[model samples]
Target: MSVATGNPVFETVGGDASAATVTPTGRTTAGSLADLAAQVVTNTTDAGTAKANAVSALNTANSAAAQATEALSQASKAITSSSANIAGGYAALDGSGNANVPGNMAVGASNSGARSFSIGHTGLKDWIRFQFYTGTGVAANPDFVFIGMNGTGNTDGTCALQGTAFQPLSSNTMTLGSSNNAWSGITSQTAVDVISDLNDKNIIGTLGNATYADVTAKLRVVWASISGVVYTLKSGQSGRQHIGVIAQYVAAAFKAEGLDAADFGVWCSTPKKQIVTKAVDGQKIMSIEPVYETDGKTQETQETIRYAELLSLGLFCEKLERADLEARVAALESKSTSSTAA
Candidate 1:
């Protein structure tokens, strides 16, 4: 039955309210108390199912949160242990369980088996400095061996040996296994043998008939008196012998070897400019400042001749003297023959 707006439609006529009599719309709707009770039951079932699903989801979230907390606690413990180990000078385990010691790094060997420590650079220029203490009575002991490599793979470098109350030994001499050899003790026979070997390769000219004594005298002309006033250590030390030829003399003797005398003179003069006057133990003292070549532009790198070159020059000097003596002897012999014939 169609009902107009604001019109009340009474369903029950005389007895109880029947579902058929109480049609709320054009289509039949629930009108009895039993039907209303069944709808209430269905709503309650849906609500219960929703509440169960929410509890299940909450349980899963709580489980995940607990796992995260346990992981964070373990990480904190590891960090604390690592910090303690570092403070106590113990090696700490890295993420890969490898022991890493602080301040000490090892390469090419295990930490326990490492025999040497090395620092290297791949660039064209690199240098290392060994700084010593400057205070009085503090032993400024620094022992280092610098090995230089070239295409032929030979070790070449300078060694400075210093002692108490003495000057440093700054010469290029190779020491092998506790055997210390002095360059001054080089025998005349050894020098001759080296000259012979070089002559075979056309590296040096013939020495003719010059004696070792004659060459030694020539070399002596280039030697200057080293006073204690200049070197300080030579003041009271008598019978002291200085090895190594003067750079200027070497340059003069080996003009054909492309050595410039001006270059050698400049290098030799550098030491004079390096002198500093200072008071030590209530007495005025002068000392030459040490020069370190960081940029590689120093006189040592440019002007200093190698020991082999010095040896070659000594042999060549002998040859020149011998040739002059031969010419003089021949002239005298010729003059005597001419006088007798006249």
Candidate 2:
């Protein structure tokens, strides 16, 4: 191609050219094209540097791809149910880094219906007991009662423990029921002691610290009110009439004398009563209910006579009356002897 034509065609390699006349289609002459040759050398150096950078980038991309493949393999193994290959551990799948919990632990029993907390040993005796053993064995016949909760399939859902009988830690200390609950029909051989020691007394005296005359006065008032009556019996008892003084009359007699019958311990007064919820009854008005008794149609406090106090007072009154009669007889005999001597 000619440079004078305004559109020059690229020349083939190893061609000769004369830069002095500016004809590019001919081979470039070495002596006349000094500045162009220098530029070509500089371009060759730049091309070599670019090729080296491309090769280095390709190696880095290949290494990253290999690392990504290895990470994917490890992640796949970690989520599996079996941990045989993951971080060299044989355990159940766990989120914790330590592979598994430190030691053996079981949340519940494997038995079909073993939902309730169960601790049993075949070597032990008949009771499937809940107890703490302090390296001691073979306790004697100690009274123990455990609360039994019957759920789902039971007819009665309520629990009752009838009396305050519990011994803690010791074989004797077994809690039978909650407060306001009682469990009866307990047959045990353990000895029960009623606390009545004389040492327990703080200020003990004869007949509630009453003087001899005071006792006699109380007994005389009580005897005057005792008018026995035969009244028709209730259905539970036989038709025979029962003889007893009205509790109200005794209370009235004491009131007339300006004294509180209850303070005297002659009238026993019971507070409002409560019947525990029965296993059969679904009605539970209160956890501990109050059932009041009716004196006629109106509610009234229940008061009963304590016959023991009354009987003791009567005996003392009889002794005093006998002494008075003996003294009268001795005086009468002395008078009769003096008259006979005159």
Candidate 3:
């Protein structure tokens, strides 16, 4: 370091040297031994002041921390005493067996599309509802969704998911039966009714009356086809007996009579499946609506015939035979009368 002498004034703070204090009257000249000594003294005093301030700050921080600890202890005590059942207290709990949250609980961070899930209770009904909201605003009305257990009782095994607008959910479809697996046959207690009202008919044409020859032919083939058998199913209906004619034999009988079974309304050999069911609690529930193939064609899976149509054809044979017998009687009576006159 290089030093030069000039009459520059240097500030000095020196008084009661042991205390390291400041007194503004003390001043010194530049480059003098007294001034250099005064600077060293001033630096010492500044360091002492900083140390004192640091100690005071430490004391203040300790006092604030003590107050905070006391506050936290009081709060914890309040919560424990208020509810005996809370925090391992031995008291009865609510029906849900869990502590209830005050407000709606949000689930999942809002997705990229601003959609999220929430669980809240409907105000009046006390119905607990799970919701999904779409709007970005905090006050936006959310869409109620998800499965819920309402206060009222419902039929067992019917579990459904309702979405927005209270509509049944249709997101995922289920395939009911596989190509290898088939559905069980459903039974109805009552006989199936056919609509025969005049308004239901299309007034296009009339059925031509059958001739005696046609009746005789149909009666012979149909009578042979009417044989029934008692048997059990391959899946075996628990040893129960069933009575029905073989549909294949019925079709063959019609073929023998030179009549196409396909041309008649009585023949029902087409098999179709459009039914689907939902599984709830390991039990199947038939609640899903039937969906058909897009091409409007039914899958061929069964064969059946209308017994009513076969019985009607048999009655026609009776009417024709009666007419033939009456005509013979009239001719014989006339001949007898003529013979008597001769």
- Scored by lDDT, the top model is 3
- Using all chains and alpha carbons, the TM-scores for the candidates as numbered come to 0.29, 0.39, 0.35
Query: RMSD per prediction, one decimal?
Result: 18.5, 15.8, 16.3
Higher-scoring candidate on TM-score, 1 or 2:
2
TM-score of 1: 0.29
Q: Point out the higher-scoring one by lDDT: 1 or 2.
A: 2
Clashing pairs in 3: 271-301
Q: What Cα-based lDDT does every candidate model obtain?
A: 0.48, 0.57, 0.58
In model 1, the clashing pairs are: none
Residue-level lDDT of model 2, residues 96-198, one tens digit each, is 6534433444565443222344543334334333332233557643334444343333344333343345446675456564223434346668864444567
TM-score of candidate 3 relative to the true fold = 0.35
lDDT of 2 at 159: 39
Q: Distance from true position, residue 40, model 2, in Å?
A: 58
Model 2 error, position 153 (Å) = 19
Q: Model 1, range 208-258, lDDT digits (tens) per residue?
A: 334445534444343222111222224345656555545555555434444
Give lDDT tens digits, candidate 3, residues 68-146.
Answer: 9999989777645456554444455568885554344455453222233444444333445455665577875565455
Model 3 regions more than 4 Å off: 1-192, 198-216, 271-300, 318-342
